[model samples]
Target: MEVEDQIRRIMEGEGLEFTELDVHPDQAKPATLRKTVSYIVCAVILNDQEEVLMVQEAKQECFGQWYLPAGRMEEGEAIEAAMQREVKEEAGFDCQPITLLLIQEQGPQWIRFIFLAKVTGGSLKIPGEGDQESLQATWWDRVSPLQLRGRDILDLIDSGLKYHQETWHPRTLPVAIPCSHVVQRLVLIFSNAEEELWVLLVKAPRLHLPTAGAVKTHTLMWASSLVVQDALGSLYYDQEVTALGVLGLQHHYHPTPGRLQSRCSDGVCFNMLAQLVPDPVQRDRDGEKLEVVPPSQPPPPENPRYTWKRIQSQATAEELFPTVAPTSHQDGQRADIGAATVAPQLPPRPRRLRELGSPEAGPGAPAAGHTDPTAGSSVALRPRTRP
Candidate 1:
């Protein structure tokens, strides 16, 4: 009796629910149940011939592909009307549909409507004089698998031809299209104090595209940093010694030098003149004269410091030996003497963190005439002192 009672209760619940069910779709399914409308794309082919009109594809989404004239259907446009308009715009010729070639359904979001079209009239031409259309339309023959630009085109064509004799349904899914961007780097250098900056533009030739021009393949940050190192090593004594911060920049598509600009860390731009002197004992005995002095031979222990007082020695000598020397000389002789004048002595200014212009010689501090305090500085002979 208990088992029978349980069965009775289940049946009563089922009966009540079934009695309340509505069979009409208006009550059973809401209007919102509609699936997303799939788009219809068309492929129009001219009659059996060696030439089939085609156009080049653009944009990172579908780059370098040749596909049939196709697009999404506009509001109120019949599916056939959309196909006709697409063919006219893409192929520039009137096309009459003969048969539906194939259908490609992709996911719940995409549908492709393809057809066999016959060329009737109006010469096939590219749309918008080949500028606004983004492609040049032309006739082609012997469509090879290798010649097709994208897998979509190849798949559509093969499916159409293969299924021409029978009806078939295809199960497909959406695929992600990948894209990339190019990066550019710039190095700005001020070679003079007049604020005249020279930009060094270096790029790998392979990174450029025939159409796009100087496409950057890396991030601007990485490019700029690498270029900074390269510029310092190739142009200066040390990267740490001379470097500036980046300046304003705009996107550049042209292939030119100095696309990027920057300012030196220091406001001034200057040149560095360095000399290395060897120990007196290790001075080169057999080699040609060199700017660098070896370590084995140290410079003299004491020498007059380089200063205006030392530089004025010649003027003083001329004054003291007035009776032995002529005050006036030929212009050519003076010019020759001037050319051989001693290098201007400079003082040490703390090395600026930037290079913006030719540096002025620093003032020399008082010291042994022939000895520079800095370990790497040069030593020059000073006037001899009478004992």
Candidate 2:
């Protein structure tokens, strides 16, 4: 079955609504050219001591050089399945992915999916008789020098460490409803005559960004737009709304009585940055134009709910809304000015499946491990004990 057809069937089975954002042909890279693209999935498995797992390749070209447990994707296989299979085969551990860390693409030809995974079962070991593709698997402190298979992997390792330290954002999903599962908010930024920027603040029950609850039938953006309109009034109804980027992520957790905890127990809030030209059309009851008021002023009686605070610095605005900056490619065109449009359904690209009997084995093969010459250096190799 076609991929899109399969996706549609799954969506239908799950009783989910689908929407597509229209991308102009000129803006979209050609899909036909990407049919031959290859995908590589890598797993970053870190132990409690901040050590990373590495595998040595048996392939002649990079013999004895260490790298992450990674491999190419097989036709008809799911992404998570591919990651599990690679980690099991290369590192000798049956693992489950914790979350997707990164999805890096090079043009339309090469794509890599990096995942953070935790070991669930299976023993670590060196490659035995039938599996010669890998020489060894071991845990490394990541500080010692070993013959690395590729120099580029070091950058990826750094990214993995950074992700482990500070997650770019909380794990979020496009939910059909705003359950306690997720916290959502919208940000409105404006500029004044001096080009100084300000952020809209609400003085309702507390001083906080405008909050919106996601609905079962609408998209997050749609729901957030509604909240913006309702909170700010009709002055912003006709303005184009564009999401700049994610402002920040906050995870809420119930506190324990004695010991401190870091994990969120309640829910996670995903704050989206929205930008618009603050050209107000409505006037106050006194017939005065609704100009940007000082941040300290009490919410005006007419619209006694909203106020604007001048941003501390230009650098602050750039940091919060990086996409607002103009680029050389956008010198003559305004890329940030347009609103998103819903497009008609576009056909899915044709999938190019790898032949079953090709020299390269499918990614679904049984798990195996490798042994490296550097296995003796600070690297620990724990073999699975047989029953």
Candidate 3:
């Protein structure tokens, strides 16, 4: 009679399709189950100005749909290799994927991996080149809600951008939430070289799905605090921390999750963690702060390496750590030296996700670790170094 019972019976009757099934006890009874063998591939392509390249769908299931260049992983093919091939085939460009962007769900039935890809060679191809769908492909100025086909697509793009940006700048481990359907968390570290890490936290919009959202009615502040506490316990680092600030929260309500994805009529919102940077002033050339360090300046020590994995969204009350609160609060306090600021409440934005991958002299074209079928001898790719 209960959802869990119904799910269990359905699974037993249908014989599981995914590798596993997870059922959690919450007020609403949240469960996540899937066949273990399934995998997905996605590409986040950027142009000359660092803008992204996306594809419009021509498939009947999602006709007139817009999504990052992507497709499903084939049997026996590696995820990374498949990604490289998919992008080249779909976008008509040869790219070397640098990092794991975001592992997210497309809808109730699909899960995907968004990768940051650097254009190594070739130009963007016109749509009618050996593809079945009569779709069009184009590049966008930024990876934001406007670029996405649906509300859910917005989160995927945002998280992918952030992952690409902070891969090498000392980021926190991906937060694992046991939410029923979605696992939402931040993935970067802001280092001021202090005794403690002062990171940002954003609230999870009610409309978005997290395993935690379905079962409990919790506040943003509480969720923010829990993330820090969980980070302190999960990560391997040294330093004490203090909560410096809580920025205002904004909610974008249009384009509900249930609405099927499409190219038009999708809305999105952001809850941001505002950091207080002290070095707001730059030495002036003559007397004014010269416009230097374009926001596009790739993070220092480029081509950082990262290891990523998907975590369950639902966590136990003990795992949430509501009781383990911050020691004290200060308006603007100095953090500990080499302190790692853990931003775990929201997903990292995608264009930002571009820069984080195995250090250059590295790495995707798929089937795990396949060489690019179309990679030319003149275009050199970095070799992978073993640890």
Candidate 4:
């Protein structure tokens, strides 16, 4: 009758192993959860001159000491709204959060969200009406030392600066297609011979990668495993499959025609490479024989949803699987492992694909200006002004 019970029944009916990973969040007992936590939002505002914004607290204990524009979240307020409100009240600037710089949590009792924001409007030192908590709002060069309200702010400042310098990952948002969050996996299934690589292509009105949604209850590996199982049935039940690395990060935006489009208007899909070993029971199957198997509930003939396509050449494989490299023996000697002479190296952790047409593309690309909008450069630091 309960959600978890229903999930268990479905998994048993579908011949799926009922592991902890198959449990969805909604199916969990809310009464057993930990107590609700409080949140503190902080904003790291930087001007064109690379000056950091700071406010002198009016409180007696740490009065006149400088701190970032930060405050505790008010009830019923969103995290972004809290950050913006703090920045306006403490720094006198109406800023827009560019990206989440850092998240610090001491269990669930105290959590802090730090954001890197850019000034959009309002003047410096001119606090919004009724803002009286800070004695003064000013910008600091950071190189010059000032009386800091708390030492923890130093780490936050460093994180903000590093995030501004080099972004290790892209910002992601919840899916806008009638779901708070959606987990979809794109798999790159390869042949056992290593001579060819195969990917599941879905032709649902348009040709695209085969993807499975509604996997928030499972790990990325487990979710991808479901996709493989749904498409290939029990053919790979005895085979060992490992997620190699991420191939790309596809942020699907809504088709709505507008300049102010959100990054995750439609949903986000994580394209990952999965290495599959030949099932001992079907070791003799050739690459052609192991073509993609469609889901049991197949799409219409005109909108075929799953088909396997062999990668034509090694060059194409190299392009698609950039992190994957075939291992070679030294001095041109061949190293034999069973029947296979070469082995593919284990890929490093997956990295998100850089967005197309970015300044990071090439040397001739123009530097991204502040006015250009969108998430800006990860490594380029703004010019500093000597205090």
Models, CA RMSD each: 36.0, 19.1, 19.6, 16.4
Candidate 2: list runs displaced more than 4 Å. 1-21, 26-34, 127-132, 172-387
* Per-residue C-alpha lDDT of model 4 across residues 144-228, encoded as one tens digit per residue: 8799876556655665665566564344211222111233345444653334556555544444444444332223334455655
By TM-score rank, best first, the candidates go 2, 4, 3, 1
Best by TM-score: 2
- My TM-score estimates for the predictions, one after another, are 0.31, 0.43, 0.36, 0.42
| Per-residue accuracy of model 2 over 237-334 as CA lDDT, tens digit each | 43445444433333322344653443312232344555554333546689776765423321222355766665665444443332222111111121
Per-residue alpha-carbon lDDT of candidate 1 for residues 104-154, written as tens digits (9 for 90 to 100) = 332113334556666777766654555333255666663544244533444
lDDT of candidate 1 vs native?
0.30
User: Which residue window of length 10 is worst by lDDT in model 1?
Assistant: 264-273
Model 2, 253: alpha-carbon shift in Å? 34
Clashing pairs in 2: 89-368, 135-370, 135-371, 136-370, 136-371, 253-265
Q: Which runs of model 1 end up more than 4 angstroms from their true locations?
A: 1-35, 58-60, 126-128, 143-149, 159-387
Give the CA lDDT, 0 to 100, for residue 115 in model 2. Answer: 73
The 10 consecutive residues of candidate 2 with the worst lDDT sum are 374-383
Q: Candidate 3 residues 38-80, lDDT tens each? A: 2356777666565677776666756655667777665434456
The residue-level lDDT of candidate 4 at 245 comes to 35
